[model samples]
Structures are given as structure tokens and as C-alpha cells.
Target: MPKIDVNKVAEILKKNELEPTLLRRVMDELRLAVQPDPGEEEKPPPIKKQFVILVSDPEQKLPKDDFVGWVLQIPEEDNVGTTPERVCRAAYDFNDTKKGSLLPVSTIGETLENVPAKHFKEYNTWVKTRTPVLVVRTDNQIPKEVVETEHF
Candidate 1:
């Protein structure tokens, strides 16, 4: 077995446009030098892609006359080959009408590709104020003669 630094060997191969078999030989030798174990099969690297549009509850503000629906796209490779269609969920606001069509709240724990469409009504933290109560009492034992105090 020969000792070779993988990075140095790679640079040499790249600089000379040499065949990789020499580099592979050094790598295999280096692997064997450490533990001298059976060769294990190499695993394929996972594919990385990008996600597109993700809808939040505030953006779905559509006109009262129309109905709305949403859809999402998930890469089949990442989903373990499951061909599931992206679905957007919308619930009625029920604020303007008595239809009770209010939609459910939409939360994003992860990416939009995994979350289904969700409808959410608005939320308000509004509160009202009230005046304190006051009472005036007249005692029954008051004197018959009324004495008026002078206002200085």
C-alpha cells in the first residue's frame, strides 16, 4: 500500500489531464491502509432542487363575488416517488355573509410544497373600555333643619 494525499493526487491528475485510474488506485490503497476492511458500496448523493410559490393567509384576499382555490408542486424525487398533486385549501370568511364559510388557519411548519391550501379568517385583538360605577346615598337620619355651608 502507498501513502498519498487525496487532494494532492487530484490536483496532479487535473493538471496533466491524466486518467483517474491512478488516482482511484491511490484512494483505494489509502482506504485499505487504515482498517483493511471489505469495500463498501458508495451511496448516490441526494438531489437538491428549489421550491416555487407559497401562499400565506393574508394574500388570499379575493373579492366577495368569487371563489378561490390553490395548488402546490412537490418534486417527485423528494417525495419518495409519490405523485401527489399540490392542493390549496380555502375556507369561507363568513364575515360578510351568514354562510359560515369561514376558512381554517394556515400555518407553515415547513415548505409550501408539503402544506395543503388552507383558508383563514381575519383576527382582531380589539378591546372596549367602560366607565367606573358611582353611587349617591342619602341617609334617613338626616336633621330636619338644613344647614348650608358657605363656599369660600
Candidate 2:
């Protein structure tokens, strides 16, 4: 392979209207995209899309009839109030017309069996705040003011 000068590449990118910082980022991404073994086939990048709704617990100020299901991060049994906190999603039976449904408290390890470890890690990070749970509303249940047609 021919040795290419990084500064020259940056200059060419700048001439083509890409900013230096953007050029660096693009180069970094290219480095990450390169496969180590030349014989290996390139794979498509994983699609990163999710419908995450942030809301307080349904038992609180929010009206109970609005949501379909809730997302929760069940903390570890022994490490209740600690940092680098781990989490798992608790199941909810939406069909049960019961008010104030129970949220199970299983260890984070249990979720690994169901959810991919990569995604669970992201969910765990998202739910670290005081109200980490996500209330997934039904298709038409979200308030009109919060809905934007352009983003959908």
C-alpha cells in the first residue's frame, strides 16, 4: 500500500469545501470502517433508530389511560444505591385493566438473555436519572402538541 500524507488529504478535503474538523471526523470514521483482513467481506453498518419516549412513572402526575406500556431499569438486588449502576427491563402486562401495575425488580443480568448486550448498555445509560423509565404511548395516545409530523 502507498503511504499517503494525512496533511495532504486534509488540504484536498479543504479545497473541496469540507472543514478541517469535519475532515478529521471523516478520516476517523474511514479508519473505523476499514476491515483488518483484506480477504474479509465488508458488512453494512447497523441501523440506529429507536422510538424512545421519556416520561415519569404512570403512578405519578401523568394520567393512567394515556400509555400502552412502560420501560424500566431494574436495579441490582445488592447494589441498590451505588454508582456505575446496572439495570434490566421489567415486564408489564398491558392487557390487565389493573391500575398501578407491578414493576418487577430483577437483576440486570436477567435482561441480557432477552435484550442484546449493546442495546441494554445504551438503555441502562439512558435510565440513570431520577425518572429512568420510558412510557410508550399507543399510536394515537400521544398529545397533539408534542407530536410533529415532519419527524415521523
Candidate 3:
């Protein structure tokens, strides 16, 4: 595991406009959560797993032939942003990348309701654009060709 840098944590919190006083409380709670008590047995891994999917707008009528791969969120710069020189940075934080990234997303999980209140609008917009539910999987999991056959 990597060491947690307190200064980096503080910097991130400050950049997000969070109060410094909350840092100590969070660190204490996190420390206890990660430490195991004496004689406590290790828990087994989860039997079920959840996944995340990226949805794009179908209204744009993008070509699907060349679209293949995993999707990653792209961050952009704007004025009034988290880093003051930029603007409304958080506004575009959750915005999906262009539909032409040539990648697919695949994973299913319950709608994430724990998103911060500040990102509600952007999150909702994504929810509304359920064009292609791209699936993200390993190279072996992806078939070399999507075959089509005719039946008599």
C-alpha cells in the first residue's frame, strides 16, 4: 500500500473548498477503519462484484463501427474552476468525454447516490444520455469478430 500524504490530502481538500478542521477527524476515522484488531480473522473476498458503465448520447448519431475499448473520464480546464485561474472547474468534472473515444464501457452497479451535491446537475445530465451502454472487458473477453448469420 502507498503512504498517505497529509499535505496532499489537505491540498486536495482546500482545492475542493473543504474546511481544514475536518481533516484530522477524517484521518482518525480512516486510520481506525484500516487497522485490524488483535485476533480478528481476515474477511473473505466478496462473492459478488459490481461494475461501472459509461453512457453517451445517441441523439448525436455517432458511428458505432469503430467504437471499441474502455472509457475514461476526461477533465477539462475552464475559468472559475477549482484551481482559481480556471472557471467553474467542477461543472465539467463529471462530464463524459466525446462519444468518439473508440472505447466501450461495461459494468453494472446501482445508481451512485453518494455523489456530492455540487455535482448533481452534471450527474443527472449523464443519466439522461443513455445511448450505448458500452462494456469494458479484457482483451480475451472481447470476441475477435461479431458474427452474423442468416436462418432459413
Clashes of 2: 0
lDDT of 2 by residue, 1-152 (tens): 89666667667887899877888898887666653777878889998754456554535556666453323354455343532243323212211213313433243433333333344354343332332234543334447586556853
Ordered list by lDDT, greatest first: 2, 3, 1
Candidates in descending TM-score order? 3, 2, 1
Give the better candidate number (2 or 3) by TM-score.
Answer: 3
As a TM-score, model 3 comes out at 0.20
- Model 1: per-residue lDDT, tens digit, 8-114? 76677678876688767866775567663566766699886432222233333534242322232344354523311121122223223343224332432121222
> How many pairs of residues in model 1 come into backbone collision?
5
The residue pairs that clash in candidate 1, if any, are 88-117, 89-117, 91-103, 92-101, 92-102
Top model number, TM-score: 3
TM-score of 1: 0.17
Whole-model Cα lDDT of every candidate shown, in order = 0.38, 0.47, 0.41
Question: Per-residue lDDT tens digits of candidate 3, residues 17-73?
Answer: 765578767766766766779789889997973344534544545554444332223
Point out where model 1 deviates above 4 Å. 1-31, 34-39, 62-152
